[model samples]
Target chain A: MSIKITNGNATDEVAPQFSAERMVEVQRIINQYPEGKHKSALMRILHMAEEDFGGWLSVPTMNYVAGILNIQPIEVYEVATFYTMFNIEKPGKVVLEVCRTGPCMLVGSDNIIDHLKLQLGVEVGGTSADGMFTLKTAECLGACGYGPMLQCGKHYHEHLTTEKVDALLDAFRKEHSTSSNN
Target chain B: MGRKLLLEHVNVPGIETYEVYRKNGGYRSVEKALKTMSPQNVVEEVQASGLRGRGGAGFPTGMKWSFLAKPEGVPRYLLCNADESEPGTFKDRYLMEKIPHLLVEGMITSSYALGCNQAYIYIRGEYMWVLEIVEKAIAEAYANGWLGKNILGSGYDLDLSIAPGGGAYICGEETALIESLEGKRGNPRIKPPFPAVKGLWGCPTVVNNVETIAAVVPIVNDGGAEYAKIGIGKSTGTKLISACGNLVKPGVYELDLGVSVEEFIYSDEWCGGIANGKKLKACVPGGSSVPILPANLVCKTAEGTDRLMTYESLAEGGFASGSMLGSGGFIVFDEDQCIVRNTWNFARFYAHESCGQCSPCREGTGWMEKVLHRLEYGHGNLRDIDLLAEINKKIEGNTICPLGDAAAWPVAAAIRHFREEFEWHVTNPDEAQKRNFGIASAHVPLV
Candidate 1:
């Protein structure tokens, strides 16, 4: 549950001392907790820093979050590396997770993978030359009804065929280019 | 006798909302619960209802409620375990999405029954949209005086929140779920201090599945005796089933217990039939966790008659014949489906989802996955099948959480029926890969 705690206690606002703007969000986040136990927000701080610093957690960013939270650096490091949801290194601007579990695999997921590689010139876990899309494989995105699916920035693109994959890449380009035009 | 277990009120949508629900006699239970009956009555009503947990364990609902240790003036809790992360189980997710209010109303009525001032719906982090609906429904309940402080002028105060889990399948375990609620790593605590005694901030909590709570609304609405009149002995009330994976008409189906397994597949209301009009090969009858049953056993009785779908009926031959109605997730496989490959895939999923809490599960799951992966990829041998079965036996009742059993059951069931398939995979590795199943290639070497 994401509660809006506006009247949170004023804790020590620790920053990474790397980027000034990202350090501010970390401050407001730390402010939501009471002082002395700032370590409660270590993972949250790391998550925010990673997203703010271009889609992945750098080693220092995890270290910085550990510093801000008054937690063991290894503790933060361990958490940051443990979860598959979190990327340790820099991720592509658009990280696409293709569903590779049973249902998807049964329903022509291989063709979708081949399509992604053919179009993006990248294998699963590799970024395209333009750094626009990084293809990754994930186990069961829970969209079985829409097997052979892909997730682009929290949105599900399900029921993919070779044609659908091609069109999907085009749509990605069109949307990104449109956003760029603005 | 076939009874209506899951699909008692099918002709209605929005069964969660108060108004849409009220038309078909919904919150009347809450009204009756508030006006006349005491909390003990509500508990007794559930005890009479004979509703099972539906979250795989099939523990009796009333019994679980009675287990709460009432020591002095400590606060009790009702945590709705809506984290339906079991493979092939999507029933709870649909229930919450389709009838958020049904669960909310159930929570209100249940909280009143349990004397719980605070309740939480620990939803899976994957279902971000579900959290929105649940939170909104809770807000509406608060606005309508169904939640928070003197609810419906009954002078009972309650607060409800839905906390999202950060993608750990093991977290669905009650103890692990409690740990996750405290914003800690999702890992199971050793029992003895079961959630009933010291759960959720070290207070007594009754963590129930979303379907379990939703059942409360119906159980309270119609008297428990009436609910008991519906299903067979032990397994009372309807059960919501998410029947998928190679079904002709795969979707959510609610039906009464004691209905024959044949009827569930043949009846139009349920699966319709297998894909390509193919003969059924095997089924994970319950969620992904249950042992698989070969088509012959699934379609037969211990005495060779067609098997029924009741709890006892399915368990006629014990582990060999039984497949749990776990999480109400029924995954079917057609004759063309390879049990070895399918078992391998399930093993890989369990390996990935293990929270690394217990040594047996953490290490055992990984090893199991590797062996199954190798087998399915054609590097398997006759001994590999026995080895996998041996490993499952080792990990079976030896873990802190049911996750180990969940991981083991599929392998055990698959080997029980398809030992020959494992032998074939070992003898003809190329043929297994020709099917394009990629458990072998899925091996991303550990750093």
Candidate 2:
């Protein structure tokens, strides 16, 4: 079975809304498709929603996206659940998705996953107690030649050694700490 | 060095920029096709070039274009499939990241050939960084006269955009890509009226791989015959092979399709041989979906003829002793790597990626993964080996899409080439966990 991560029931909460500038950007994205095909912008808008609304899609958040496209709520929910990229449940601030497929495995991705699990003090799909980091194993991210890699947000950290993992965690922790202080 | 049609200017600084790419003779194909040639004339040139799809299936690109049902007064769409999720393949991502303009140029040129007024590059979501690069290139093209309204005074109007897929490997399939583009689940639609007849938004559509579409830039610029002269027969263009797994140099390399497998594996110019001086145990010459070949059979056919890297040559013996050059994902396995473990890993990937549309693929992939996992983790009887083969036979041809066959072939091939290893895992479960089965005796003589 797939991993499910949810923070209690969020259905009763008010649906999140996009900001004015973000709404303009969403309109531009909808315009990319032909007329009456505003549904085509659903995926891009969901990505924006995920980024802006606490890093995961709550029930109310998906409903808000459905309202934006003027589609059925079921349409939004089915699509949100189908793709693995969207997080239905709340996650830590930083989600480290490491590639654990064939080529990466051959190049010692197993050891990297084990090392991450030990360092984070969590299992494969668990987040740390402080809600700082969540560990996840992903399928191929297409950087096969540069194996033993992980993706934190948009950047890919490749050729991972234990030392590189240590430095990465430290850097992320430092950045978070500095930002929170501000 | 082989001639690089698509990546000739890849090393030039700022090739990713439109200014630098335009300075190095980029967008010439768009000019050539739009300014002079008719749409049918462009198709004829591609047919003459003998260019097969660089995507896994080696179908003739020209033939696929010819099948587009051009109904009067209907808009046709061309989608560039940038969903590069095949396990061992990374060439598409590299090409898009390094020289994004080449794909932009190819998209415009090929769109013109198909008389398409709108196009989209459906890239995988994981490569968000690469998507940003291509989006910038597309914006630059729009800024110039290359895109949007009457190009080169040809009265042809084209508008291009990019679509991002939510993380799903099934989205790489063309139908699934179309579904995803329509903001739906990435379940593949049943085919009969292939995409040629009924596609995106119920209009005729043509979807081509990123590499396949990029090849059109060179095919139109220098004429088809010139492009056809580079590689061997049937495989008449340079191919980008992404070499990974236990290689001295593991990255993307473009080679003439007829280069010998031995030369590619051992040559200083190519992979530079196995990493750390380890002997090669086996190789998945194509992507992870294709059959794996034992070391002795990798460089030579069953008949002992040299195995060249062409589609026909790689598939010399029909899976009994041959494998396809699928997507040119050359994955090498060193002597220390474990086959059972690697096979289970791939099976798990398939299980995770399966869209659950077809029962055989949905259930069979999970079953195969479970059985393989059990065997790899040191708990399986001898019957589980045959059980895997049985499941493989059931899933090979029972699905609406090729994902079923793809999931079946590797398991089938691993057992075919390394049955003894599977048996060893069953009999010596504890020892198997301790050490690999080491390169099973000389190639098990072609059955």
Candidate 3:
């Protein structure tokens, strides 16, 4: 696995930082904890930082987060890698997360995953050549009853079928093409 | 037709809002607990209700709450465990999504009862949408004066916030949850310094599952004894069963505990029977962690008594012939579904979520998944089955947390109940590779 940080550099000179508006929100999050214990805000801030600096937490980004919390850079690195959600590398513009755990698999998630791979022309955890989509499998996102689900951003597409997957991919392609052209 | 305590107002329009929920008697428990009942009185009532933890372990909720260490000048915290990552469980998510205020109401009552001035809800990061719903509900509570300083003028200042776990299943464990809450990796801590005594920033803390906290709403409203009257002995009150996989209607159903397992499977009101006119092959009654049961054992115990959906009844024959009502995941398998493949999927999930804290769980889970993978792909001999069982035995009680046992039980149960299926894969590798062996014969509706 290649640990590619942002700008292809892991040195301290990178000076990773969040945007101005996000820094204010980071302060609000830090205030949620007691004094001398602002480290509790590290995860929340990392989540925001990941959102701020694309969808992945680069090494510089992790170091910046550690700086905000007055903790060691290793603190942020340990947390970023420990969580499956935090991506250290750049992903495609649209990341398709399909649930392939027991319940989802029991209800045909495997077929859905295969369908996604074929449509996007990318294997699992592989990014599309056009940098439009990335296909990844999730464990279980608590949509067991509405199995065969996938999450894109905050929305969850549940009770999925092949037809639904096709429509979703088409819509995402339109979305990606439209957004990128701007 | 069963008593719907938590979800009674779920379908009522605008119950997601504070005004509508309050109008529908949503926070009556908060009012009752804060105004009429003493702190100890509230604990005693919950103790009388016999409500057990709904997050798989089946520990008595009231007993767990009573264990909170209340040292002088030390603030207590009540953390709501909304990290519903278990494969087959989605009931908590349903409750939070549909009726968010119900949880907020329950949290207020629980916080008041435990003398907690501040509380937090540690939800899984994947439920980003649910977090918004909960945050909106919390905002509504503050507007309605149900939260914050001097709530309802009872001089009880309690604040609730939502924390998102950074996508780690091990964080669902209490100590790991506390560790994650402190902004670190979610590694389970050693016992003796249990969360009750030392938790979340070295303060006395109590972590309750979302459903368990939501159940407190009805427990306080109906009184502890009255709430206990709803279900069978010890497994009192209604449970939210999240049924999925090969069911006609895969959704969350709130059922009284004493309902028969057969009825739950086939009743139109519950799972609505298996889908596509297929036969019931097997089931994981609880979440992914519990032992999987064959069709026959699911409906009736080893001694041939009709099995009910209570905690005790589900564990009827111990691990040998019984399963658990763990987290009420209730995953049903149709005749065509392959047990070897399904078990492999669960093993893979465990291995992915092992936290790498213990050697047995980290190493054993990966080994089990690999062996199961080989068996499923028709690359295993007959001895591999015994090897898988041996792996489960070594992993069962070796880890610091029950995750080790959780990973082992399903593998052991699958082999015990379906040994012939394994041997078939070994002896007839080519044929096994060709097609999956399915259980024949459809089960008639028992309800």
Q: Model 3 misses residue B380 by how many Å?
A: 0.5
Question: How do the residues B1-447 of candidate 3 rate in per-residue lDDT, one tens digit apiece?
Answer: 577999988999888888898899878898888889888898998999999998888899889998999999998999999988888999999999999998999999989889999899999998888988999999889888999899878898988888888899999998999999999899999997889999989999999999999989888988999989888888889999999999999999999999999999999988889999988889999999999999889899999999999999999999999999989999999887778878889999999999999999999999999999888878999899999989988999999988899999999999888777777677767765653334211111211
Which whole-number lDDT from 0 to 100 does residue A145 have in model 1? Answer: 45
Q: Give the alpha carbon lDDT tens digit for every residue of B255-291 in model 2.
A: 9889999999999999999999988889999898999
What is the C-alpha lDDT profile of model 1 across A82-126, one tens digit per residue? 556678877777888887666565556767888888889988899
lDDT of 1 by residue, B34-70 (tens): 8888999999999999988988888999999999878
TM-score of each: 0.87, 0.96, 0.95
RMSD of each: 5.5, 4.2, 4.1
Candidates, DockQ: 0.25, 0.79, 0.76
Q: Predicted chain A of model 1: TM-score relative to the true chain A?
A: 0.74
Q: Is candidate 1 or candidate 2 better by TM-score?
A: 2
Write down the TM-score for model 1. Answer: 0.87
Candidate 1 stretches greater than 4 Å from native: A1-83, B1-26, B437-447
Q: Which of candidates 2 and 3 reaches a greater DockQ?
A: 2
DockQ computed for model 2 against the true two-chain complex using alpha carbons: 0.79
Model 3 interface CAPRI class: medium
Compute the lDDT of residue B218 as modeled in candidate 3: 89
Tell me how far the alpha carbon of residue B133 in candidate 1 is from the true structure, in angstroms, after superposition. Answer: 1.4
Name the lDDT of candidate 3: 0.87
Error of 3 at B28 (Å): 1.6
| lDDT of candidate 2 at residue B140, scale 0 to 100 | 98
